[model samples]
Target: MEEIWFAINDIPMDVLSRLPVKTLLGLKCVSKDWHRLISERSFIRHQLKRAEPVSGFFFQERFQWCDDDIKAISYIPVKMEGSEVQHSVFNFLPESVVLSAVSNGLICCRSCFPSPQPVIYVCNPLNKEWVTFPWSTPDKRSSLGLAFDPFKDPIDKSTDFKVVTIHQTASDMEVEDEDKDSYLTFDIYSSKTRTWHRSREMCHCHHSLFKNKGIFVGGALYWLTDGDQILMFDVQNELSWLVTVPIPLVQFDSIPEMCIGESEGKLHYVLISEGGLHVWVLEDYLDFTWELKYSISLDEMEKENTEFLCNIQQRVESRMAVDTTPWMDPLAFKDSLLFMRVAARIYLFNFETRKLEELCTLSMLGPNSIISPIVLPYSMSLIPLG
Candidate 1:
């Protein structure tokens, strides 16, 4: 029987990698040899490279507290069930763990309570597997980012990942005049080496960490700065540098929100304004040149005659001149679907047709249970942990 299963599992590596991650996970119980083979790092990498489209969106639905918003802050996955129905998976993630970013199929999460600084973890929700970073003193002072290669090996369950931490002076630490602005260091953790190393003092140490999450595209981690500059960390070479993001057309007051992202296997920037959401691709990384690719008109979205968010114009009008404040941070962009959040409501916008439709309403989760939900891009992969 074991020999029969072995014969069934033995196949061309590339051919096996082409199979869906769910199919591969199902094959693991067929035999011990199959389990070992399916768990190979190279195999996982290959599978991720050929993995299918994103399976769902992972967002946190927070519940209000009696005092100062206890914020039952939770990580939840609202998975797509066919075209219209969505199912949520909660309690699978660690409690009070704030997920900051997702790369490939793994999400980067940090501890939110009990400690002044958070402990970081890289997790795979599909398999309920996670790996925690070794606690270090510097982790208390820095913001962390996760970067991985999802395209080359999205299928394999064992692709190595890197975590980059930017440490500034600890808020609680008493600082002398000399120590002020003297504490810029980056702590990098390599899964391959299973170790952490610190870099020399970075130039821009005093600037506070950006409130927005970091995006990893083309093997580099990107973070926005208050001074309109971007911090780029090369994951492959483990080097840090600053780059000026291409300036967008001034469309509104308060400087319309924008962020860097990855689309179609290339690095791109997304600008959200009253005019529309403009996409600019970084054509030349060497010269820092950009090319405007697509400009989506928000006005067209208001014209769609759909039941979902049909009265968005009315909702926007009630907020005086400020209008509505979207949750910011798009979940994922693919095949014309732009997933984003407006407060507690998640919507799917089609850039081609300019049709905006609500995907899911957190009010269904319970009244006021959806405090400060964050939209995160989710790609299901066959990731396994030992």
Candidate 2:
């Protein structure tokens, strides 16, 4: 028995790191040395680098009254095959907390009840470990963004994370249009020192920032704003800038549907207008240059998926059984595939083949239930949050 254990430990780390987290967890019982090797931060990093990160979607349902509010969150695996390992990833969190931001498998959640000072939590659902801290803010409606990178700082023994909050000091009625962009205050929290730093530096956002959670990509946090603009904050340099949206292809009087997402380690902007659907990629990050990647008209889409459309119409009519208005929303992007919502069904549009396939159908809650606009991207990891 002793000789067999020694032979197993002799396996090269490069080969051992390729094993799945579940297999590695079982291997830890082989010996103390094996447990130590699996628990080491360097070994964990190597395993993450060699493995494919499992991605999924988080759907949040909220109902609000004057003071009483109710919220529920559900996890949906994006893979076509029903090979999901975990069904309830966020059941570990206590009640009354809503997910704020998701980055690299770590989620930032805050208290949903109205409060001047709210308790913020950073958690890893994979291992069921979490850390909490209180944030002092007068505004209950302020926006919070989480930035976490596993390989951000090489010197640090563990992964370091940061949380940023943006809020305006004055009410919208008191602030004029010219001064609206100047009154925003930024509160930054660092995990290394476990402290919050306030910055009053001006970030020129002519429009109000969207209520949706910010997207983190390439060392920066991005938030969409009204009037076709994006607000960006650099976590490393502590600077803020604006990125302009590309002009719409069609001259539509109403506002078009727009969303920002991350794919292949780059930022992408998607727009759905009366003319059709257009996708853009940030080709040059420094110069803020955008290159249109895919453009498909509604006519072309209807022509391509006529049979699928007929089937979806029949499903919705039979299952929904309500006079609800249909909607199409872009949820997230990954590896050149677009995840979108049509009515109550989720779909994946392949950019290479120009084909669309149904992923899953969301359960209809009730006649009055409406799907929330926020669909967060999730990646599974075994990284600990301290």
Candidate 3:
């Protein structure tokens, strides 16, 4: 290995950055010099730029019928055409933990319900390095968000990463009635300081924020509410506010199925309605201007993959109530690729080619359970949290 490193020591960084993350990781062990070069923040960023838009995804199936909320997390590689879901990839974490939020290549996993004290673990599955955050008291009805920017100044001693927890205020939680008024509040945990600070800001909304993972875009974290608004929290300023969703409540007779994502540092919203999947991008963040980028016809997709979808539908119907589940659910969007679920199978939709290809099938659920897999778009990175 020493001789090999000496022979290739003069290789340009541009060429080395183009190498796969796994290859770069192996090269780090060649010599201390190679390790230092690979560990530089600039090299990490350049390598990420050369990496695929999205290398793969991590998804966790939430059993709607189970109260424990303990589920197995699986990974599906995008380049692997016939890859089986890797179930043991996250075996380093506790089995009772469920995926809550993911940013960059780091994922946040929270302990299951019915615990005296709840805990959250933020880690990079690629390196298997993690940090734990245990609460002294139980936090009821909260949504966790992770905010990490690789471009942040390395010299800044304030924060390397942050975890924002949004929840109902103590007084608001005391109110048992769902129709009563309540206040939304949040607390942020800083990785650099290894401490949490509560925010003074609060807002009133019709219902609680969806427990789904928060979406990180730009420098803020966003969580969708039960109503047609999203709660946005600024990481640096430590302020929170609400932004109206693109699809107003007045426009739709009933709520439409939609999900939020980020691509190229801009927010993108995907909604499924009218026998098609509509994509809207926030072109102007300040003015809140949205532009319709793509409208894909699900009918055409169904026609092309009739046999495959039929087989998936048969398996889905045997386990879940077909009427309750959305026919086509958008899972994650990144770059030009959109990961969605038609029946129990996940597919990759490329905007450049306007084609959809099957990626993997979700795991089977118990006879009494319904599966609703939460998929997070992931790109491999070797950045360390500590």
lDDT of each: 0.61, 0.70, 0.70
Q: After superposition, how far is residue 228 of candidate 1 from its true place, in Å?
A: 3.0
Model number with the top lDDT: 3
**1 versus 3: better TM-score goes to:** 3
lDDT over C-alpha atoms for residue 109 of model 1: 73
For model 2 the local lDDT of residue 58 reads: 69
Candidate 1 lDDT at 253 equals 44
Off by over 4 Å in 3: 1-11, 26-36, 39-42, 49-52, 155-159, 169-179, 249-255, 300-323, 364-371
lDDT of 3 at 277: 65
- Candidate 2, position 145, lDDT: 88
Q: Candidate 2 overall Cα lDDT vs. reference?
A: 0.70
- The lDDT, on a scale of 0 to 1, for candidate 1 is 0.61
Better of 2 and 3 by lDDT: 3
lDDT of 3 by residue, 194-280 (tens): 888788877776655753458888888877666777777888888777777776744543334667788778778777654356778
lDDT of 2 by residue, 183-288 (tens): 4568889988999988756575557776355788889888877666678888778888778777742345434566778777778888766556788888766678
TM-score of 2: 0.82
